[model samples]
Target: MTTTPERTEPSTTAGERAMLEGWLEFHRETLERKCAGLTDEQLRTASVPPSDLSLLGLVRHMAEVERGWFRRTLAGEEAPPLYYDDADRDGDFHPAEEDTWEEARATWQAEITRARELAADRSLDDLAARTSRAGESYNLRWILTHMIEEYARHNGHADLLRECVDGSTGD
Candidate 1:
């Protein structure tokens, strides 16, 4: 059986950057823990009928989010959407029959790695390379906090999804 990933507790007395990164990492591991020990089919199962949210779908969506915020916005790369476009805005939340858990996990992890690399040398106050659709630029601090918030919110969804998947639940 697959095992849950271990999460590190965020330090209370750490500096701003460390605290933010710590919480983000903790939430990331929380998602992985929620999806752990599930087969490809289990990962793809949409336990909630009205909501087509699955563990695999969440992973894919987060991958897209990471790439969008870090690669495209922060680094100003030309990366396009991996699963969605104008016609399919919710594509990431709807994994195809052929989509596997392994592939989704790999893609998500790679995006996280790339995001860290992109933000490594930049200061928290460093402005992003690109502006939002409303023409507002964000700094690294805002991006990091936003990412943490994003993961925290999604992790809550993941908690319910995991319990529905196999009767597994935890913080």
Candidate 2:
């Protein structure tokens, strides 16, 4: 798979914004690169152990994750969770056979676009003004850091999943 181009934050006077931009860029590129090349069947295929984790599922889950962190939590939307059913938290990673590739891809693309548009205009110093999953309040700084950590954790999962799928490695 080819690595997506790195988007080093522009050298602007807005230092905080630059940092947040860089973090978002890194994670976004990481995810896009992880999904590079693979048929619809491949995207939905699980690893040898029969786990439910699939590339398509990961994309769907990450889209939901991005929405949760950057949009809902940061924007203080008080909106309900996306694709998150309390009864089955693991549902994000378990793709039904009926799930079409177009649906999954479109959902991910929409979330990514929304995140970029929202974040592009704001500085990290600009308060996101939202509460955490635990109901704790947080600023944009905390949210960006938490998102970076979340993406890193999932990239590790992507690495393993990619290796299992095609023996590919590295960004």
Candidate 3:
């Protein structure tokens, strides 16, 4: 049984790095909170008939995102996709139907841990090894903000997915 990551998102506002970390942590915790107490089946249940979205899928998706951003792009490591493939780009969310909540949560937590470790020694101004869709390189500060946005958007979906799964909702 893997232990869940600590989720004490800082309440006190601080510097730019601290603020970004707090918001990112808050978003990560929101995803974990939505998945908490859910059965594997509940976590795998899709939001709707046409939509493949689920709590488990979101967790997997975020894990992939974290690895891509922090390891592949930022760290200049030869990191490959953890879930998806060239033939099946959305594999992370699609094949998640059979994923256990425990497995998905553990993988997500591990990715989060790795991302924190990668970013610890870097400054906000550090440049990434990858470029954005616009063909422009970005910095750690941008990556952090992008991560916050990514999780925030997905967490909103998680809100609906959780509510749909069990009618649970809150901050």
Candidate 4:
């Protein structure tokens, strides 16, 4: 059984960067904890009928999101989608039969590491190297906040999925 990473409680009064990063990390670990101890088949089980939102799919989706926001938009790299593309926009949410829990977890963790490295030296007000689809530039602060919000929203779905999988639930 794979063990879940420990989730630290974000400080109540940290600075802006610390608070944002802390909350983001907290949510990241929360997702991991929600998926912990499940078999690959279990992780891939679309327990929620009509939704097909498996835990492994969420992990894969987050990896693509991390790569898109940090590696592509923020750093201006030509990092293309890992699990999705023009023809399959929702590919990440539908894990292929070959997808494994271990691989998905590793990819998600790698993206998180790269995201931290990319954001380390930038100021909150630092503009991204690229602009949004609407041509508006996003600062580091916005990216961090958006990432946190993204994780928070998915974590809610994760909570329900985990319960459906094994009757396990908590923060």
Taken over the whole model, the C-alpha lDDT of each candidate is: 0.92, 0.73, 0.87, 0.92
Using alpha carbons, what is the TM-score of model 2?
0.79
**Candidate 2 — number of clashing residue pairs?**
0
Using all chains and alpha carbons, the TM-scores for the candidates as numbered come to 0.97, 0.79, 0.91, 0.97
lDDT of candidate 3 over 1-171, digit per residue (tens): 534445776668688889999999989998887888888888888966679888888999999999999999899788788789998999889654456877877888898999999999999999998888898998999999999999999999999998999998886
Tens digit per residue, CA lDDT, model 4, 1-171: 566679899999999899999999999999999988998888899998999899999999999989999999899989878888788899998887889988999999999999999999999999999998899999999999999999999999999999999999778
Candidate 3, residue 33: CA error in Å?
Answer: 0.3
lDDT of 1 at 138: 99
State in Å the error of residue 23, model 2: 2.7
lDDT per residue as tens, model 1, 1-171: 556688889999999999999999988888888888888888999998889999899999999999999999999999989888898899999898899988999999999999999999999999999998899989999999999999999999998988898898778
Best by the lDDT measure:
4
Lowest lDDT 10-residue stretch of candidate 4:
1-10
- Which residue pairs does candidate 2 place in steric collision? none
Off by over 4 Å in 4: none
Report the C-alpha displacement of residue 70, candidate 3, in angstroms. 0.3
Model 1 is weakest, by summed lDDT over 10 consecutive residues, at: 1-10
For candidate 4, the clash count comes to 0
